[model samples]
Target: MSLLASGSLLAQGSESKEKEMEAAWQAAQSSAQAGPATVKLGEQATLKLPAKEVFIPQPAAGKLMHAMGNLDDERLLGLVLPTGDDDWMVVAKYEPSGYIRDDEAKDWNVDDLFKSLKEGTEAANEEREKRGISGLEIVGWVERPHYEAASHRLVWSMSAREKGQPADAPQSVNYNTYALGREGYVSLNLITARDQVDANKPVVRTLLSNLDFTEGKAYADFNASTDKVAEYGLAALIGGVAAKKLGLLAILAAFFAKFAKVIALAVAGIGYSATKWFRRKPSGSAEPK
Candidate 1:
């Protein structure tokens, strides 16, 4: 083929991919539920999402994540994006791994936890390299793991960058927050650039507070006689448990440049009205209006 024809075809292919990505973004926004709404978050919990933000519930959410280069996760309940200048995202997932004991949280030493995470991430890098994803190194904790016994909540943050990356290279942060439930835990991870994490931390915390497990699903309702317990404890959730998950969360930064335009347009004053889905709620909670 002529060089001119080959170049033209390559350009067309790139344009086609961009169009497809933009289409996915628009579809997700069209279906997104604007906040100040009560919506079901999987079978065990509800989200009282606030206004000026939108929640892209599943199926559509899963497609958008795939387009954004994230691996498929059945546990993904939905995604939250803002309608303002906060260029960040919150990924919400529900894991029915059974009750995760939090007793270990009290005994966890920050230094020990950091060591475990560093080692675990180094191991996870092997898998990333095998898949052709850039190897990442933990830059250190943005926020040390903190657990609230009374609320059954946990919060932590970490930053990572490509191995051998210059010290001045941009870092990606994952500000993770979790709400423990009788069946398992619900996690809301805020994905943003390192420089933006401090400003967006409160945003994710607000969403965490808005998540409520249905009656009988609260952590306090665990029936020790009949309920199943997770094999790992809270400490594992921070150390080994987070290593694989962090790899995926970290990769999100690499693809932001590709989809930034579409995302910016969606969040730029677009009206994302609320939409209801088939929610499974226990008897005590009020039905979606």
Candidate 2:
């Protein structure tokens, strides 16, 4: 063939290949958007799985499955499985916040909490051994950090539980604790009844897994700021009343302080209303009120 003819043929082949590749890509994308099918594990129970690779089991009969995702940290997922018998299973995926500093009392307290949890596990194991129970095991302790914004505090929780307990039997529980700035603080003996412990794990795990620690910063800051505002509001209210009673500048200051938030809120509302009104077109005909 001539060189020009050969070049033209090659170009046509390349264009055909590109078209095929584009078609294949589009097909794959469509399939991905279709999502996974729902599967029934037991009577009246169903599980929804994503079209992606993960293949989680469908829930069994009489079990309710709950799932929540972190708003900021999309990677975190929490699942709660509540069995009708009051038994629960919780699964969480996310690192707890904060670290245990050596100088902090909270650090030492957390250590003691873990020690107590271990003791509880050992005791439960001993009891199981004495009873010659098979398949009974202490699954060790799990700890995570929980933050309380109201107090600007962080709690390190260490939980211990016995696994493979009979469905009807009580579960063994032991826990350790630590606070953000406190040390060597041992918590009181808090025990979970066997049945209750079994029932709570699923819920707790689900809650943890679904938590979005990344998005929590805004909420934490909002809470702290709001507390200060509330304090000021209360003071302003009191001062306003007192000033009115005493005939002092308290009334002016009180009025400004007491209504600051309300006034700001009203202004914001009015601005929003005006914007909406401006964007709307007038109706052609007036309707009767």
Best by lDDT: 1
Cα lDDT of model 2 by residue, 1-289, tens digit? 9999999987786665444333322222222211244433122122343342121232210111111100122212222222123322222222222222222222334344334433343333454345443223333333343444343333332322235555554334422222221111111111233435444444333322222222223223334323222212111111222233344342232111111111111222222121122122334422111
lDDT of each: 0.72, 0.28
Residue 44 alpha-carbon offset, candidate 2, angstroms: 29
**Candidate 1 local lDDT, 16-75, one digit each (tens):** 655555555656756778778987998899988888788888888887766554567788
> Where does candidate 1 have its weakest 10-residue lDDT segment?
271-280
Output candidate 1 Cα RMSD.
8.0
Task: Judging by TM-score against the true structure, name the best candidate.
Answer: 1
TM-score between model 1 and native:
0.80
